[model samples]
Target: MRRNTGVFIAFAIVFCWFALLTFLLQFPTVFTEPWPYILLLLQTHLYTGLFITAHDAMHGVAAPGNIKLNTVIGFVCALLFAFNWYPRLLPKHHQHHHFVATEKDPDYHGGNFWAWYLSFLKQYITWPQMLAMALTFNILTYFFPLENVVLYWMLPAVLATFQLFYFGTYQPHKGEHNAENKHRSTTLKRNHVWAFISCYFFGYHYEHHDKPFLPWWKLYQEKDRSFK
Candidate 1:
């Protein structure tokens, strides 16, 4: 099947799943006790899926010759989590793709297990200039009152989740010579399954790295092709 076709199939499945979950959340009996927490978690998970889809769009992996469409999709997806719609960040993310596994890459893996663990914190907190970012997030949340959650709280939380997800997947594939490489290689069996089910198969990072232009659904096909 074509990459785009696969992506559409994957997207349809994910959308349906989220829709079902949302429907279930509306029933007090279905969600049972602690409905608020359940709803929040479900919403956050759905938002993460949207965020990954937006990332794909930003990379032009979701659409062709339609930059505006990609921008609009990405911006709308970010808004679901109360994030800023900064088009400039797309270029920086693209740059990471170019350098993939190297230290010279700002997004490199950068150390051993412990080091990488610590680095994840730094990536999510420090590099973004946490205090200033927190203030900005707060300001944004204060202005927007979607989902009853303060905009500031939601923005930072969602952005932090994205950062952690990115680092967890990217770091494993980074080069040994890279500043963040504490190990020669990393495994993704656990993460991949969870990401596939939770983050809309975005944990298939190795496959994505191999065929950057291929849509998400065809990512697995590309992985299979390498063995063939």
Candidate 2:
């Protein structure tokens, strides 16, 4: 219970924030004001939170006490964020870690930004994901305001993918993952606040690859203690 507090807190924040943001978007003139734009960013952050929590679950830290509980939370998070399938992501993520920056690593496609991003997407995105998203969008538009569903629900998830890809994958694993950098990953300069806001401390990513057991929330401390 003590060990599991952070995961539960992170889970609640993302789940509750997503719902709360959706509820707030139901008001009149919401789009006309700057509130919607701010909310979009907040929602996007939560979407990233969803994926981060899921990634933690992949490493067996989300609910360290119970394996079943951990998997369920991860599955729900992935599904809620973008209809992403957790089972599919699990193997691919481990494979990326095993292979690092080589061609065997599904997430690494080298220095070219768009090419790497497209390769990254190809490994995760599926026809089922697209179909499920399309179905959800259509179903949501019938009961909720179309703008609310699109802006708060859909757009944020899309942006969150780019957020995860950029800070978590591309930045850390970019450039040469040579012999000196055995982990084949990079660590950002010390900025705990910026690290959390950017990608949930995943920017301190060399610490992550080095100490895979540490949860996302703990990576910054690892960064400070070991790296610099």
What residue runs in model 1 are displaced by over 4 Å at the alpha carbon?
1-37, 109-156, 159-171, 174-187, 190-195, 226-228
Per-residue lDDT of model 2, residues 112-166, tens digit only: 9999899888888999899999998898889888888888888888899999999
The prediction achieving the highest lDDT against the true structure is 2
- TM-scores of all predicted structures: 0.60, 0.94
Q: For candidate 2, what is the total of clashing residue pairs?
A: 0
Summing lDDT over every window of 10 consecutive residues in candidate 2, give the lowest-scoring window: 22-31
lDDT per residue (tens digit) for residues 96-136 in model 1: 67765556555555576556555544543443344555675
Root-mean-square deviation per candidate: 6.3, 1.5
